[model samples]
Target: MTSTLTRLPRPYQSYVYAYPHKTAYRPLAPRPTLHEVWAGEPRDPLSLYLHIPFCEIRCGFCNLFTRVGAPGDLTTRYLDALTRQAETVRACLGTEHSPRFANAAFGGGTPTFLEAGELIRLCDIAERVMGADLDAIGFSVETSPATATTDRLAVLAGRGATRISLGVQSFDENESRAAVRPQRRADVETALARIRDTAVDVLNIDLIYGIDGQTPASWRYSLDAALAWQPEEIYLYPLYVRPLTGLSRRDRAAADLAWDEQRLRLYREGRDHLLTQGYEQQSMRMFRRIDAPAPGPDDYSCQTDGMIGLGCGARSYTRNLHYSFDYAVSAQEVRAIIDSYTATTDFDRAVVGRAIDADEARRRHLLQSILQADGLPVADYRARFGTEPHTDFPVELARLAERGWLADTGPARLRLSPEGLAYSDAIGPEFFSTAVRAAMAEYELR
Candidate 1:
């Protein structure tokens, strides 16, 4: 049952993380009640996500569901709404279920964009409304080098944030400018110093390749500069210019074959460089220092556990459904959605989402697990599905193997070869069900 379709094009799509883009999600009419969504779902060891959708400035390549800067008291109003949403979610989970969050993350345009006092309140909401101890779990928060001020870093570190990921897309001034992310190298270095002064358990620096006019030498310089701090983790991302993003209006030649070839060369170069630096490749994008402290519960898996998302842009996942408030990439649409979210009182169930049937679930399980460098565990897949992954995704698996993207490394594992991992973006999309792709295609990109 191998796929008869043509292999997807190269320099390959980038699979930073996750699958089934939010565009694939449609409005759920007669949305299920939260309790109904969680019915018979395991309550222990869940993941919690708190989204702060405000940033000081929106980068050119950014298309995440976040807005640039807080308008007036919008920040205050947004936090209030988040609190209300958390309360509703917790109530729905119920006291009897005794939901224990195993891991938590604060992400957005930049969680550190909030003032020091605001950040304290954000942590309080997680503690009081959600019953998640900020200090007890593996808490990770996203920050920008410009926003990682000492006061903010102190607040995060004090609140039990184990990992702080700073988005330093590139250290080269021209590359940064080309990506429309302006900052002085001195500021980034100062922020790095301030972060280290906080003595946080893990420091993750994010770097982006494929910026317009970026070269191999420039990419190495950025990588080397990041390594100077001995960050616990590093994520190298390929820039994708999506619709409605700042970078979208750029010259058409930005995404040509020659540009892609340059990106691929830089990616491989950065990857090999990081490996030599004693960092382990967790995925194509994530590389962690060998000595970095292990974060998160080993038993918790996104496939099996539930997640609670507390902001308009945040998304919650249950066994059968993935949901969130309305999603938008355009600024006006994003503001409208945020305004609507702030005005809403009914926080009990999903509004915008796509229901996942058994087949979609299997596909998700495989797509999420197989993209990692370590690959998918056959025994675990069998234990959950009562059949081998090969049986469920025969066409997909066979095609990958035929193209040298997959290798059966052992009786208990089906892993992607390095080449296959390089093609993760292409491979991941191949597993998308026809219905999902069509739904996504039909979606209006507001």
Candidate 2:
């Protein structure tokens, strides 16, 4: 059994590590400034992402670009740099064009770690630079239970934040302690209550199963606890070990940490329980209210290269190219990365295309379609790519159908069965190239 597991395909190995921690990427050398990459469509829809890379304390499992320091005036300086980056992005994307900045997301170690006033300033700068009204934008912010206080909630509300994703990894005290993320359940409830009456219309709770002390029974209780909160969205993620993270070292040194199968079982059990509680499974890890806005059918995961990321270790993608800046290296490097943004550059289109292969795109569409209670729309796919979904990938789709993983809801529409939806993560990368597969394998080793 061990040898079989060791010899598993690269896609399977990669999928196992898809669980959450923090964003992982390398920084670009001799940081360049934002410049005009290939001009996107004149009226292309753009999303604004603000990276607030500051954390009170780093989680043992996190590999995100965040640091521990409450240096005086740090928030002010970070916001200033972010504003400059936004300005550069506005110029590069074309100022005169009213590109639809449909959504805005604030993510990081913990956005609420910054003073409320700092967050407001960042929002003000974003609105002024993007020329987009805050009321119409789909703004979301991520907060940790320890930092989200009544005051912070009020500041976020005032800034027109629409969604609040609370990092409530687990309600179990032991599990929380083991994860090195101690939070009072009451504090999280209070934060949720404060956001409930505010402009933050969506409350998404993030839960982590498959932790060191986690089991199916324990995870079941966690789900029940989460459902009691009645969050608009729930993201159930498995625990993953990353190199250099505090948790990885502990797990390695501990004589008896949880095994891989235990983690997998926890995920499977938790997912099944969530579906039973009336939440609609959206992506691989996200479950939303039945009526929430369904994510787009496009390969958004691979298309996230052009986003203008701010803060420490944030990455951006433009014209199918990827670039990142690291704040953890040094204050000078961080500032240099921000100032290096210019008006033009070469992007990795081929890499982007490879990242979101046809199989991956199809899997994303199918998973989202099922989550939305709709089947894949043949006409839309035809309209977007001038080809039918089945025509482009009949071999795989037909095989899945034969295995009862897919169902023909209509002439050109197919829906994933519950079983297929459960396997969505495993199914997405079945068509990656050998080279891509090898790269994924190497990533796993790191």
Runs with alpha carbons beyond 4 Å of true place in candidate 1: 1-8, 14-16, 253-255
Tens-digit lDDT string for candidate 2 (1-446):
35322333211223422211112222334334344343653334555677876787777667665666547766666777667666656666665666566566788768889877777787787788755566666578898877787788888788777788988888888888788777677776777677676746788989987677777777877788888878889988766665566677663532222354565567678777777877767655788876665433232332222345544445554543344542333334434543433211332211111233454444444444543335567776666556777776777677677766675576766677765554555555553434545544544322
What is the Å distance of residue 12 in model 2 from its true position? 6.8
> How close is every model to the real structure, measured as TM-score?
0.96, 0.77
Winning model by lDDT: 1
lDDT of 1 by residue, 1-446 (tens): 43222234654554535546788888888988898888787888899999999888889999888888887899899899898898988888987778999999999979999999999999999998899987778599999987899889889999998998889999999889988899999999999999999888999999999898888888999999999999999998888887898899987664376666667788899999999999998887889999988876787897677788899988888888899888889999998998998888889888888887888888888988888888888888998889889888888889898888876697689888887876777788889889988987898999
lDDT of 1: 0.86
Cα RMSD for predicted model 1: 2.9
Candidates in order have lDDT scores of 0.86, 0.61
Q: Which stretches of candidate 2 lie over 4 Å from their true place?
A: 1-12, 15-35, 38-42, 197-199, 251-260, 291-308, 317-319, 326-376, 388-404, 408-411, 438-446
Model 1 weakest lDDT span, ten residues long: 2-11
